[model samples]
Target: MVAGATSQASAALRTYPIAPGVSVNVRSGPGTHFSIVRTLVAGASVPIYCQCPGETVSGTYGTTNLWDNIANGQFVSDAYVHTGSDGYVAPQCS
Candidate 1:
């Protein structure tokens, strides 16, 4: 390999896949009560910057209270993300 390629590969690995066939809502906060900031296209993959506890949700994965912070002010239910962990996959959001 090439320089920095390993890091790039590791970064790619950090991204988790969204649930199949669903256009998931990206909320401003970690709960359904939060306003919708945007919606993700089906088959979207997102890199989780952090995670936080919020309202529990059930989706293609399983029910959980953990929310994955994909970007600043953007969060999605962990139940919709395939992170291969039932718990926190990134640092806790502050």
Candidate 2:
């Protein structure tokens, strides 16, 4: 009965619902160094096309904050977002 509810979807499009109490940050870039567009409340959802390139954590570099990819993280500010799984900023993304 409604198995894989989160994985189920219309046609071939599989939608991943926001995890319980999960927060997806809306960073400017793939990684840190970008400003936040805004914060989406829990239960809010967006169509995710591409995901931030997963990074390897290193003590010298820092924790694996994918948002750090913003502006190359060399000459730009980083934006951190904390929202429920389905929540995220989208103004700049639009």
Candidate 3:
């Protein structure tokens, strides 16, 4: 499990890192900041249960994508999903 956060399975998670070099962003308030999750890299798949579609959006509901919190084996959004030939997280787990 990740440090500061826990698995968001309880939440309606989404998929992220659908590709590489995409760099899924960890924002300070759902959007903006563009701070990396630190745990995820290109290809790292995460389940986004709580999504905040856009940075300017006011609420988390009515979000388009399935957003996951990669604090514990999770992912935020596909914004950083890999765009490589394979499109998957590297050094995969078991």
Candidate 4:
């Protein structure tokens, strides 16, 4: 029998799935309190570099205190993202 290799390295990022037909606002910071940087189209998949506790946001999925860092100085509320889990899947943003 051939042996399969296993890797222990953590993923550098995670995919944040957005619901169909729902546009999401991308922010300069982690919450609505921050200015809007841009908007993500429906069915968009973004790579979450990290996460952090931010202002609570309510969306189609529900309410959450987590915000996902999608790019350099960009963040989006986790309440609108289907992360396939109920908890933090990546490292917290510093």
In TM-score terms, which candidate is top?
1
TM-score, candidate number 1: 0.87
List the candidate 3 regions with Cα displacement exceeding 4 Å.
1-16, 34-39, 56-78, 81-94
Q: Identify the superior model by TM-score, candidate 1 or candidate 2.
A: 1
C-alpha displacement of 85 in model 1, angstroms? 0.9
- Per-model tally of clashing residue pairs: 0, 14, 23, 0
Quickly count the clashes in candidate 4: 0
| Candidate 2 Cα outliers beyond 4 Å, as residue runs | 1-15, 54-94
Task: Report the Cα lDDT for residue 42, model 2.
Answer: 44
Compute the lDDT of residue 18 as modeled in candidate 4.
Answer: 85
- Per-prediction TM-score to the true structure, in the order listed: 0.87, 0.37, 0.38, 0.84
Q: Which pairs of residues collide in candidate 4?
A: none
lDDT of each: 0.91, 0.34, 0.40, 0.84
Query: CA shift at 27, candidate 4, in angstroms?
Result: 0.4
Better of 2 and 4 by TM-score: 4
* Residue 22 in model 4: lDDT: 91
Q: Against the hidden true structure, what lDDT does model 1 obtain?
A: 0.91
Q: Best-fitting candidate, measured by lDDT? A: 1
Q: Compared with the true structure, what per-residue lDDT tens digits does model 4 show for residues 33-90?
A: 8999999999998988889999998887788889999898999888888887767877
CA RMSD per model (angstroms): 2.6, 10.2, 11.8, 3.1
Error of 4 at 39 (Å): 0.4
